[model samples]
Target: MRLRRSPAAVAAAVAALVVALAGTLTGCGTGERAAADGGNERFTLRIGVIGSGNRLTGPVGYLHDRNALVPLLAEAGVADITVHTFPNGPDLNQALVAGELDLATYGDTPALVARGAGQPTRLIAQAQVGMDAGIVAKKQGGPRSLQELAGRRIATQTGSYMHRYLLGALSDAKVTPKEIVHIYSSDVEAALERGDVDAAAVPAANVEALRAKGYPVIDSLAEDHPAYRGTSATVVTDAFLEARPGFVKVWQAAQVEATRRAKANWDDYLSFAVKVGGFPPEIVRRTTLAEQLPDTPFTEEGLTLLEGTKRFLVEQGFVRRDFAIDDWIAPGARG
Candidate 1:
């Protein structure tokens, strides 16, 4: 839950850049929200979760399982919590724009793309960073590098961090994107085992399952590539941010508290994830429980990673326009 900061000198420079980018975050607002209904008024906090459900490792997972946010939001007069799941980031962003979500958790690429497209939202905090994707192939024999996988059938969950990782890895190795086989995460191991695809770039949690089946693992984005290391953040639509500042702060505090509790009960938390995620317990324990979960105020490293993601999205035509990372984040958050 500790966020790594940039060196002081670099932080100072980036701080200046943030101040410059803050204003462009939202193109236009619908004007100020109407006054809240009285203290007794009950309102639901709608949250968009990217992925079927994490309910085990992230801030949302911790908060959701305990029904913690419901009480926390009560402090600010919000009464209920509703979590909606999306298979991927792009789909989640669509729901947000349609006014179905007030807050969301998703990868930086789709968030940036949504913001660049004029979605009035701000990244209030980060829940994950430096996550690595595993590239696994059939056990018999497989390519050693991304370059060798060129023109080969590569599998991944489309519109996920794994998808972006595969793209960045291939690009870094000077291999162009071509003939990718998109599939669900659960099917990755089967795809690799049966030679349905020469290789699959999947979330780390899925790697152990493949390895258990004797699939040969080739590379990890964390070890071999820095720029594409994955990240997921907590964001709030501008409408929510403007209408209930206290609610947002309370929500952020709940996330931090959830992180604290999750860290304290690490093993139990992993076990809980296994049930909610329907994956192998060992996979959840090894891949997510061992991985660091982050809390608010953001981090300098996250900003750098986000900048790289934005560049990649824009370059690949995923994002229709350019937007400043600083402006995309919560104005109050320093990172």
Candidate 2:
């Protein structure tokens, strides 16, 4: 049965919602909030992101960050919400450790690295997962299969997601990094182009771009290993959660709504991304953002990936010890 409210009651409810959001926007659950005359403390949220100049750093991310619902933060009694952007994962992790950023978003592997190193952060939500990632070879080298170039050189950015993906993909094919000439290259594509490396693991977009230029894709990481699926997440500090529980809900709800809207209206979302993110329309059309947001904020499937990533990092000696996945995943954080 459909329930309806009286006009006066509806107006009152709208007014209350506006008041709550107004308060939240004004303060946003920031530092050292004071109790008001009614004995209530304000909430301030301080948000941080990694790097600038990418699609995420520009208009696309902005539309998601500040939208029609964003203003509701002020109504929710939050006074100050500040956003800070760092150049990379390490820098963003540093900001979190120093108590500068209340929330952050980054790849799954890096988050595992941070937690394994004893950083006090928890995965609150997932930003993206299940991307098309793979390894590519220059056309001239013509390495078509994992076994074909057993002794050839491979290139990948050390300690990055692609690095982890390559390691796992090779292991699945019973290939060892030692068997291949491992060359550390700052530029994977450049290394492949110059014939300095036989193959390099990269995102699906890069793979397609390279293949279009006549590069051979030996293996797709996402296709071969379900565990290697993309998983970008949103993290929060314990301190922030303790101070403002309501604001946490607000933030999560906003992200959830954004993801839902983006999915339901995909072409429109991509258009927004291209126009605002500064990405070429062609690139946006070629690459898929259909899996941009996971159905749940965080899922058992994703946490399993986290476990795999942590184990891989520890085994690779990238981190000293492996952290229990449960330690960093706060209960009830996922919706």
Best by lDDT: 1
Tens digits of per-residue lDDT, candidate 2, 1-335, equal 11111211322333344345444423443223432312144545566775453324222254444454445455545565666766445556656655666778776765666665655567777667665578888778457898765666676644456667877777677765423333333256677877876888776666777777778888887677768775776787655555555555666666666667677777777777666534467766776656545666676767777677778777865555566766676666654
lDDT of 2: 0.61
Candidate 1: list runs displaced more than 4 Å: 1-40, 53-57, 139-144, 289-291
| Model 2 poorest ten-residue lDDT run | 1-10
Q: What TM-score, over all chains together, does every model reach?
A: 0.83, 0.75
In model 2, which runs have C-alpha deviations exceeding 4 angstroms?
1-46, 54-62, 75-87, 178-187, 275-282
Overlapping backbone residue pairs in candidate 1 total 0
